[model samples]
Target: MKTKLFSALATMVAPTAMTVGSVSADAVAPQTSKADFSVVAKDPTNPTDPENGTLVLKSVPSFSFGTIEASEIYAGFTGKVAKTAGALEIADIRLGKSDWSLTADMAQFTDDANKLTGAILNLDSTGSLGETLTGAVKDDSPAVEVVKGNGKHGVDNFKMEAATLTLAANPAADLAKDESFTTTINWNLSSTTPTAPTA
Candidate 1:
């Protein structure tokens, strides 16, 4: 009876089994990838891979005065003025200034050794965006302000025409033959209205 009573007391006093081993665990945090962003101004010659907010000189025309006859030269030839060829197209975004102006040099036709003696280029831009020109001008002269606009800052085209052409009498009196001449038209752009350069 004593043994049975001691066993009952020990069972009531003993505690339950417990686990104390180390537990393996790991934690995770959330984050995002980072990189630098920017835009750079570049020449617009090629538009294949253009990025956003890019400005480019899209297209321009090559003016050509076709073959002239001796009879026409004697009477002073005049060629047709048309924009059948491409016009000047400028592709701009809102990144450019709200206003812009264009300046171009009045080019003179000349060959390797001789200039067209009395040839004239009349740019009659009276009602157009360009300046009206009615006289002969030097090639190396200061660029002439041709076009100006206000409050328009985006892609657009400008038409160019040759109002008239007067050829000089043949000084050499030689038989009529093919003659080719080229002139460089230097173009300038400005954000503000450009004043005509003083002589």
Candidate 2:
């Protein structure tokens, strides 16, 4: 009996002694991973429309100078095209590469009668927008730089204030009754320094 009791006590105490030994739980971390990302600009809706969620250049409105009496001596007339601030807005949303600019064509005004040569439109460079129109440009010549865009996304907003077109008149030009004159002023937006568009 004494031997059996001792054996039972030993069996019970054996588990307690085994628990005194060190028992370890390991801690580990999984390997890291990465994900790639990219973006694409949306296409323009129409020739006259601005693109969605991307860079877009809108067509400029036609400028009209009311009828003026002709003179034998050289004369000059100036017409305001965009007087209100923020009238001209360029929308851009490119990521990382956000440099852009604008160019306007210097052109001669033409009458339907094929007369009035040497009449040119002049754009003033100094004005409210920190010399926005610095120099004059004409058609058939290199385009005039309009804007050195601020590198940004939607945060960048630009407009021209007090922009005008001056018409230089020559006396020898032939006259026409109710004569109409028209010229196309092309505007281009580029990611780099701009050149005039091809005729």
Candidate 3:
């Protein structure tokens, strides 16, 4: 009986084949994420447009320059697009990135007849939320730097109370009668925040 009791005690005291197991957790593939930015379309000018990929380029101002008369020495015209007329708008929702900017480049003014020779459009813009966006698009010489994340988040929309477009047409350029002179101001959205151009 004593021997049996001793055997039982020893068996109970013996460490049961100790085995250690480790637990761990890992991050999934694709690691971090990214976002896509875009310049909002001029036409339709819809901020809530479902087609705006990643919800970028939400909206922009539309300039409605009334009528222009032909001139021989060159004539100048100006148009205003106020915030009421869809002020410049942009939206960004990117991950792992926040720095962004916008630039403007005006294409040549054209119509059904031909290009408006020696014609140029000068763009003057400003931000509503106190952003320095004073820039222009002179003959496509590096799209004028419009705005960046200057002390504001990339997603922080910088609306403008007003924007000015000055149109100077060539003098005596065979003024087409009742012809519609049209042009495009390409608004580019970029990832890097470029330096706000001097003057």
TM-score of each: 0.51, 0.54, 0.56
lDDT of 2 by residue, 1-199 (tens): 0000000000000000000001111111111111111111111111333333445543232223322444411353455242322223444554455466666553444444433334333444332233244446454466777665545545333333344444455544444434444444455556642211223
Largest lDDT belongs to which candidate? 3
Q: How much is 65 displaced in model 2, in angstroms?
A: 2.6
RMSD of each: 37.0, 35.6, 28.5
Q: In model 2, where is the ten-residue run with the lowest total lDDT? A: 3-12
Clashes of 1: 0
Candidate 2 matches the true fold with a TM-score of 0.54
Q: How do these models rank on lDDT, best leading?
A: 3, 1, 2
lDDT by residue for model 1 over 82-176, one digit each (tens)?
A: 32344554444534443555554434444344443444444544322333323332344665555555445455665556534445553442222
- Which runs in model 3 stand beyond 4 Å of their true positions? 1-44, 47-55, 77-84, 93-97, 118-129, 154-161, 192-199
| lDDT score, candidate 1, position 97 | 47
Residue 125 lDDT, candidate 2, scale 0-100 = 39
Name the top TM-score candidate: 3
